[model samples]
Target: MTTDAYDHAAVCELLGAWAVHALPPSEQHAIPRHLADCADCAAEAERLRETVRLLDGPDAPTAAAEPGTAARNEPNPMVMSEPTPATRNAALARILAVRPPAPRTAPHAEPYAAAVAALRALLAELDPQPDGGPDLAAWRTPVIHDWTVQDTVAHLIAADEHLAAHLGLPANHPQDPQGAAAPGDTDWRTAWDTRTHRVIAHERTRPPTATVATWRAQASALLACPAANDPELAARAATLVGVRLPVAEHFLIRAFETWIHADDIGRALGRPVPPPPAAHLWRLVRLAVRILGLALGPTAEPVALTVTDAARSTEWILGAEGEPVRAELVLDPVDFCLLMGGRLAPEAVPRAALGDEAAVRTVLGRAARLAWL
Candidate 1:
């Protein structure tokens, strides 16, 4: 069938049946071609196929049962004969097993390295498949803040160049036009926005592939710098992006922005992006909390704040420590990150607040306004 004749969404909905070879012959033929160009659907198809493989494994019980239970003729307690809550969990575990482990990094740069790796994985989904489906040229689709997928990547290339330049790395796009003001003369925020606009304009003059190549090359160069792997090397403080922070924290900042934009692209493409893994997520949360604290200063009303994930919980007292907390707020770590990224509004983010609502609202409002992303 012609590409336009096949509904992309309808093909996507058939992924499960296609994985199990249950689709009609014509659909079976069309789906693989569709999967080739569609990263989101391709990934889902792989997952469904993996699930089928696991479900088709040996019919013997998953574990040995106690002696007396073996001959009961009842459903085998050790074998998953049908889907149950536990069987569903086992299926999910099998699906996750297919993913590669996160890359290793030094303690200080771990968050950046992991976040970079995570974003790369997401970007890979956008890669054009050898067998072909939709034209990869469609990457020009609008992503966020008036940036197309290619433009978003071009923005990151410009963004990371700041740190890469500070580290003395060779520029990936040396011809990129300068903003209105000389580098340091402009505040980082103004410089940042201007750089993004200039870079996007410059990149539009080239093929989207060239933009992706430049971004990937620059990111790889940044990660390869000695500072990324050595805490001592990263300890030298420098001011970039309007904040004075060590090179290590700057690396974390690079990670934070990369993941956020990746999320923007994921959303535009209809894929739900999972938050960063727990360890790296907490690093982002802690850093954002510190920055938020700095923005709030010491005199604001104190609010006892707690952020939690599936594995653990962290607590902090926002505002003056000497004063009793006037309110309490609790949030999921991912929700807090989204709030800090400005993707979630202060009032709309899922959270629990008590005591003085105004004080809690202040903390939430300040967090949402941080706009570091």
Candidate 2:
């Protein structure tokens, strides 16, 4: 095929094989350029690459043997012909089954990295048409907080800037004046709201694709920071988003916001975004519960709350422990998160509650008011 008229569709179809180094050399030359220009294709390529890496296992060879080398000449009886179609299909199925590829992060930054990957995957789903047609306009439709999908991403760019700057990473987009306020000169909320507005306003002046590129680049930079891979660097405490906490938790905050906005975009597009993979969900849930418990305080009546998932259930004794439990609440972990994020109203959220009505109401109301999202 001529380079000038390369068939992107055909190249995309070969991505899986290319990812596994199974593509013939003649057919593989065009993929790099195509991937560089195409966001959807790039995301799919990365996922396929990750799947291939996992299949190869950690100790796999780094390079192919030279054609005339002893290693290449000494083929054992174990060598086999190309896989049959069914065998190939089964291998592909197994690779695809490994959901949410593990993020390249230190233990503490894992949640944030995974959340970023999840959001990238969701955004990749937005472009359903290979030719890139009118359906692209859907990205501009209103999502949450009066922000469109494009605006929501721009908000994340602004949201993540705080931690990025604190780590001394270069800003991907122009910095909002408010975003650079000295610590304690401005409260996080005021600074946050101001920066978001300014960032959105600035982003509106550009195309949505540009805004997304900026956001993606910034997130990539954050994940690449030394702090993301070093517990020692990330252990330092700092004030971000109104909470004085270790840099590690701030990374989680980034994960939390990215997942929340991705959900917002998913909802506006009429797609139900699944919660993060179980382990990441639990991390998020545990963090949110800790914050909620703090918000509930020692004086509030104690309630026995259980958040359940398919594999396990976690129990939290919320509020004062001196009195007999005034209420019992059971919630699916995702529902509890939605409730705390203010995405679900107290009256509307699904839950099982028994005992003192006032205690249940207080817990639910406080949960809704947490509004971290």
Candidate 3:
């Protein structure tokens, strides 16, 4: 109802649309006044606004040349015209000039940097203001689990904290107040979940913008760390999140999870987020395949896993080696990554398979199980 006595649940349902300015004028005007007196609504609104800011990128004209350059009556090709390659390049250059792209890093760390930048661009679309700032009221939109959009971001701060500390960056928020984990508590999942719950709860008390700032700041610091820039530095292995791997591989894991969660957030907002760049997508595919192989272990029955894209097809033998391949499975690069990310059900994901269904199902099942996101 577009009135002061609005049903809270109904109003909450509209927050996503409201944040994007999709509601009618009467509803738009009423929601803000309603927010003013409702503390819960106000906090949720603020969080949505902050999430919107992350979606924004520098502005550039979509079409047409400088003002007055086009003749008034003559058919102006620039009007409603697709930009030429040169024009597109120029626009991209301008965007970079206004807001520089992610920092350069070693090959292993490149995807993480790019994914971070991509998420920032995606989040900007929530509620872009005329002044080029974001002010959406959509943060309360449900994403994964019971987490709202704001909570998803706060979870990221918690998720990335382990890697951040591994890289020698200081933790932005203090440890969960529940208690110092028992000395013998070696379960990374329990620890990870605890910290995420704590961080999300803590972040809920503050403006959504503050939580975003903390997440972005920590990410920037991680990118700036020497390990991110130096292949040798990142080569040193350290166990984090229950896996022992080189820091470089861990960086790729970060990129993988960030992209996955960003996609989740986009889905919650009714936006279709594109997959990561081709090269980056492939890197994720390879890493996921390797991890899936490990999870399947060396003694299990082998499956011929082939990941293909427009440019090339790469194959791997998963499970035990000496025996003839029992099955051949083919997947699109993105589909494979999504499967590993746990975004797609193994049975539901598109694929081409030949040979034993049991072996195929095994690979798919293992891949889905690997999804911790």
Error of 1 at 326 (Å): 0.9
By summed lDDT, the worst window of 10 consecutive residues in model 2 runs over 75-84
Tens-digit per-residue lDDT, 169-202, candidate 1: 8766544445332235446687777777888899
TM-score of each: 0.72, 0.73, 0.72
Model 2: number of clashes?
Answer: 0
Each prediction's total of clashing residue pairs, residues at least 3 apart in sequence or on different chains, is 0, 0, 5
Pairs in clash, predicted candidate 2? none
Q: Sort the predicted structures by lDDT, highest score first.
A: 3, 2, 1
Global lDDT of each model?
0.69, 0.71, 0.72
lDDT of 2 at 160: 88
Best by TM-score: 2
Highest lDDT: which candidate? 3
Candidates, ranked, TM-score: 2, 3, 1
Tens-digit lDDT track of model 2 for 1-373: 4555645554554454455444434434456567767787777777765554455556543444333435554322111123333343333444323443334678888777766655655564444333543245777889987888888988898888889889998876666664452344446677778888888989888877678779878887888889999999999998877667788888887877787787788678765456677787788888888888888999889999999978989999999978889999999998988888889999998989999989989998998987855
